[model samples]
Target chain A: MDKETQPPAASSHPRHHAVPPYLLAAMAACDGAWEAPESMREIISSQPTLDKADGPVSVTRTRIATRARQTMLLDQALLHERSTAHQKLTWLIEPTGRLNRIISDAQGVEITPGTLIRSEGQKPSADIDVNRAYDGLGHVYGFLADLFKRNSLDGSGLVLRGTVHYGEHYDNAFWDGTQMVMGDGDGEIFNSFTSSLSVIAHELGHGLLQYTTNLQYQGQSGALNESIADVFGALVEQFVAGDDAAHASWLIGKGLFTKAVTGVALRSMIEPGTAYNDSILGKDPQPATMAEYVKTTEDNGGVHLNSGIPNRAFALFAKALGGNAWETAGSLWFNVIATRTLPENADFATFAEQTLLQARRDHGAGSAVESALKQAWDTVGVVPRLKENDDE
Target chain B: MSESLRIRVVRSGGVAGISRRGILELPAQEPSGQQDPDWFTMAHQALNQLRSIQEPATAPAVRDAFTWSLNIDGEDHVVPDQLLVGPARTLAEHVITLRGSR
Candidate 1:
């Protein structure tokens, strides 16, 4: 048969448009019969108006069918892109160990470890370990680019920059508006922050949130921002390692803790207590429930501590949804953050409501997104409006 | 005489004004008919318990009182008054030095 003339294989799945058996099953359940074209049309037409109360049911059905058809086309486009296989590319490095000079059409940019040349008072050390910082940044950058089609922290392809070994045995890593900074862990309880991929991803994720939602850095909204980073960071690690939610270890800093510290992990996604049993660190200090919620002043008004509530919620949601965390749960959270309409001070209840709304919009009202979102919030004691009665 | 496994606990990383080194030597000789399955396991558990007692904010203060136990040949030895140095890497290196028996 001529290459272009050959008919598409009937049994063979399309590279991009091939819907998973589960999704297909769900679509079938929405109507009836696996291959019923008529039911598929009905489900597709109704999807859009499902969120609206007064929209005609028939109109909604037609909208759902139309959307399904569009999604199938988008899937085909995604498959084609994958089939082309974007070549892994890199930019040339200068003699001073910098990619300062960007060559034409460079696929990736290099960030050099440097001191804050512009900071006036109390200039910290610039003697950063370039190799470690580079690797960490590179891994996070590659993750965003490969998975989400994100060019850089901002979708417009922002230049990535990092400073390593910032202070004398600095114990933390943080993103300072423009660039990411890593501290050589005071060789005791913690190691170099750049050593863990999750940490790097976590930091970069902060940058991503800044560019996207710009969530305020205090109270529940700030906690939500931090939690989003933690979720995405864990996902980046899991995605790179090709591990599912069940197989993945939800610890934020698995290797950062020194050998002297006897802890399973820094933070546990599945079971928060399992992260650390140490007396010095005070048993991970993370509460999985609102009842155990900590009201504190430290760590940016307990931004890090209170984050566990939302973090655990996301983890439970992903596990309940099953399969890849990034594919379903991750996408839902990302969409919520990306499309948030509330101010930065939005509380947990507000965030939960918005997430439920977004999930319903993205995936039908009573779809898997609804159940997963309900299950996740319920697990964390933040019952959504629909399931408030069911929650105990 | 049985081979002795000397496991050292090196402490590091905390605020200034704290000594950051300690060593626990576990002698290899144990009573006959008894076996210490995994020395590291027991030592780690003890270390974790010690860590949880220290407040994270006052890590430097607690570092001054750095202590740990090692199980060699079925016996536990507690090392006390350890120094808390710059970071985990330094402590790890110090532990290596103690393990080297130099």
Candidate 2:
């Protein structure tokens, strides 16, 4: 038979595994079915291997050996066992040292993981976002693992995926339930999202919240979600810069805005309502206290707006503690989100109560931690719930 | 609902964060003797198609994303990232595009 003819055994399965050009001739010369497991064959065929000889592409389709079937069955059982093991370890509990990241170039389009320019363990690319995303994700992973003693976002070392240069003149970054997406700014109001480590951390913080507390994305709960992201965002920045809470700027997106825009930063945790005050962007509408809380149907019930209350509360709580926010205040916040005590529909009042509970539980009743959390919440006018029955 | 339908579509959130709403009201039900069966069929078909679509799972809501809230008669339905698909999508495009002119 000619080398171009496909073997009868291979034709039966119709699932052709790509063979090396040399292997194709050899397999054709043999005129026999190849012996390999179905799953292993699939694994081999998916890899990109060159055909040394420029000829008709070769493929292997063959019968599964008895032992090979057993191995495949064992592999399936092992996969099931692993799945079951991790299923119970939900809430970002798994610790994976290897920070796997994938950076995609959106190419002025709004698509995810658009064109894969970089992958885990690969060297950096010429694109600034590729290298920046890789480094930024690495920094975040290190911060969480080294400081928090936790794994990546979702706790199982979830593959951190990022798309940079997403959309033409896009002006923002977001964590869309899966990966961190960055946009090259219009250069007038904003810069590259990767320009600030805090921005990256802030977006990743959303992922952590998703895998952890999963605070409702509307009203007070939504604000809490945003606040958690901002808090950790600042913590990530401080931890990386080795800055204490007092020294930390507590700005959510410090360098995100360009000089042309009249803004010190996007949002300020230290002084909630003072992030930015500009003509083009309008005045910063964040309210620092419950008295100044904005009641609006917009921005997910002013999530990004009212978050200032808790943001400032956290800043105060951490500053009053007189140390790194990530060490004391940050740990408490992480514990509040990581534990199952936090409900999906938790409001600011409930969150404060939980923080107080965690503080008392962690540091004993009437401890400094408990008082600091109480004072912070009280200062912000968020009265901690006495109990679930009487508070609401 | 009352042999008539009123739809108010509100498009909110985006880069500019400007919100706009437009209302499209269908004529009330004609008496049985005066009813146009073909017109009723068309109206029922359009409304059914619009209400049948459920938002796709895994459809991410990106930054500066647009969300749509459709108040049909009295019941309201909100779709994050506009949940565009089929007749509902076509109607939303028209409602949002022509919101200012109306």
Candidate 3:
């Protein structure tokens, strides 16, 4: 079939997937509902006496209500996932109302409203770090939810879980497959990574990418992925803080470093290399233009280094678009990432093309998209395919 | 030697204010080391003047060192070291020192 003419496939699987009438009725009575056999089994197992003992009608009703609430939460989670996948939006719902039994192993820990764990060595410093992580996550989550109407990172009402003081002097923050882990920075130059809103948002952006494009974290595609996080992270900070392009500092880790450090910031979106200049860490190595781009192995194929190019592109785009960065430029980038069919190894050229396509689709095929696209790529020394006689 | 108190006037936090911390060892008997009321009033005045001079509109016109000031008793004294300047984190330490010293 021709690609343009192909129709969306209708499922041919058995039609035994309808919600039971009783279940539907129960769900309708409540705000919402969901179903997970594993959760039900765990709940039932936890209250095995319910199976053996003849409880009062109220007791049975309470159990049913509890199960229904769990189901509702699961349903919400599913809905959030579907919405995020289809709409490029996130969802946030309180998890306390749900009945999912969380379990953890030695290596992993579950984060929930009630689950509290002490820090290693019972250090007071660890408590501070943990609290900061929690606050930072809450802020970023609220920013995404309030500003974009997103439920969560996955758009599937997923709980935002963060592990604080992860590892010994990890020196970085990262999103594992399931949770966000923050490292306490070395005391000399950096502090707790959780101190900055942008860093939290950046890690969450990684989760967003995983759910959306699942961009491979290597080479140019990796750089694009990293750049996407930085762009959104910076925008999240500005949006939540009510900062505008002119007023925003455009620094990634504006408050993550200690006072002893003489650097400007972790990274600068507007002026790449100018973020910092120090003797120990060397000058900001990021190159704003394509001519000076560094080809290195550090930072996962120079993920951080090459990111400066796209970072500057995003900054320029935001400045030209004016107003809040998240309003137009941010929306454009988010939509492009959501819609682009990116491979794991997609490079800068691929990203540029997809962005151009998205810009045209979003803003019309006019001078605005053309100029923005050209300027962005040209600034990074990536030559785009030219249209014949367009200059005239 | 007459006793003198060394007072450092540190300024931090603005659009792009840096974290600057400096010490001005004053002779304990310096004229500005008078009573607390006179010292505070002078410090307030000096801070106000410094802020006025560092207004966003005229920030570029003022030199970096101009951001710092020393209040002696009831008079303003300018200092040489610009102290801390740059991003938020860089200025955080100066804020700590200023608060701690006072």
Candidate 4:
């Protein structure tokens, strides 16, 4: 952030804490303690019945709350951010009534937001893509606002502007820095890009990333950018379905293609390289581990392909925690971006380390959140440099 | 113009990891003001068109994005993917077909 905009560093900007107040106090008191006291282990484990019950969710809710506070702290760096927190000691309040939707038509051309077909508080257009786009925007915005207290794509109500039917036979969707553009596929291979909630949220996720770290759109960093989009995109889908991480499909662009294409989705977070296998679109070329990472000078250094590694790591992490993926896992990843702890050109190792640090901060030292994140990165073969350095 | 205006498009990155360049290079010029009159007029027109454009700021980068760099003579202009239009669009499509990476 520019010097003019930086907030003074303090613990005084109180709103809400995802990590419970008592836990933060205990963590502060314990200081160097890695694991919780033996008596608290079951609570930290987070299963209610000892046979899988939904007891006090405040433990999970508190961790989410702590990260929520961290998120607000970091978000001051980007855009005109207002704290989306509720009163001092309350859980996050919902952004139920504030939505600014603007849907437009490109008329099969490239003109941006071609004609304003639907504005905020207006009725849905007759076009399916327009309605789908509008609903998708609401879902994602609701996810961030409700879960993380993020106001919008910019952490302030940046109008969720979108244009549908952009260019004939066009087969992609993108955020052009300010607004979104969706394409109607060529009908033979793929359907309209707006068919998938993940696809729409994925494009909007780019807007979120842009406002934060603005990770350079090339090489490994670009892959992280793509992976971040896919990660949050899947979260949006999972959140709307009310699915826990275990129940979530972990597919990035499911339902985007036609049946003739012989593919399930555009990308898969859980199983990279296996999302599609078609005679026309070739194969899904993502690598799930660094061992198979593609070294290329194309796709901005295989940003779309190699993103699968981190994508899988995020999926594994959220599933291991076994709850709403948006709560803990989402907070850690969002912290990495919002904190600017990772460099603009950060590699997978760098990203993994920042997440680890966030896990330690929001959760206690050596907490299960930290353990899950560590295992997730390790399973994907992304051993963080900081971990190795600490081990040394 | 037909012989001298080489409309080249270098397409980089799409679904497939493919990079291809197509050059419709027109004559560099036999510029003593002595050439086929029609061709000379076309070349001047193309040159004027090229000189008229000042490349705009870069557009937001997209995943599996196809970036088109149009090089005319020695002057090069990078066309934002969403904004490719007019003669540039016509030329880019020709290049995409030529490379078969469309």
Q: What are the per-residue Cα lDDT tens digits for candidate 1 across A1-392?
A: 13232222222224313543234323323312112233234444644322223344543333333333224323332543664452221110000121221111111112224433322122333433455555556667666656555556654456667666656565666665666666677698888877777877887788887766667765677677778878878998898899998889988878888998878656776776567766555466667888887775333345666678898998888888889988878877765654333445777877888688657656666897788788888889985543342211
Weakest 10 consecutive residues of candidate 3 chain A by summed lDDT: A98-107
Best by DockQ: 4
Regions more than 4 Å wrong, model 1: A1-129, A385-392, B1-102
Question: Which lDDT tens digits does candidate 4 get at residues A325-358?
Answer: 9877987788677545567788988888878877
Off by over 4 Å in 4: A1-97, A387-392, B1-65, B69-80, B95-102
> Per-residue lDDT of A68-122 in model 2, one digit per residue for the tens?
2222222222334575664532221233346889888999987776998999889
Tell me the DockQ of each model, to 2 decimals: 0.02, 0.13, 0.01, 0.28
B-chain TM-score of model 1:
0.29
TM-score of candidate 2's A chain against the true A chain: 0.75
Q: Tell me the spans in candidate 3 whose CA falls farther than 4 Å from its real position.
A: A2-126, A367-370, A385-392, B1-102
Ranking by DockQ: 4, 2, 1, 3
Kindly list the per-residue Cα lDDT of model 1 for residues B57-84, writing each as its tens digit.
4212111112333333344444332322
Cα displacement (angstroms), candidate 3, residue A8, comes to 11
- 2 or 3, which is superior by lDDT? 2
Best by TM-score: 4
Model 4 TM-score (2 dp): 0.72
True contacts kept of each: 0.00, 0.20, 0.00, 0.22
* C-alpha lDDT (0 to 100) for residue A227 of candidate 1: 80
Could you give me the TM-score of model 1 versus the true structure? 0.56
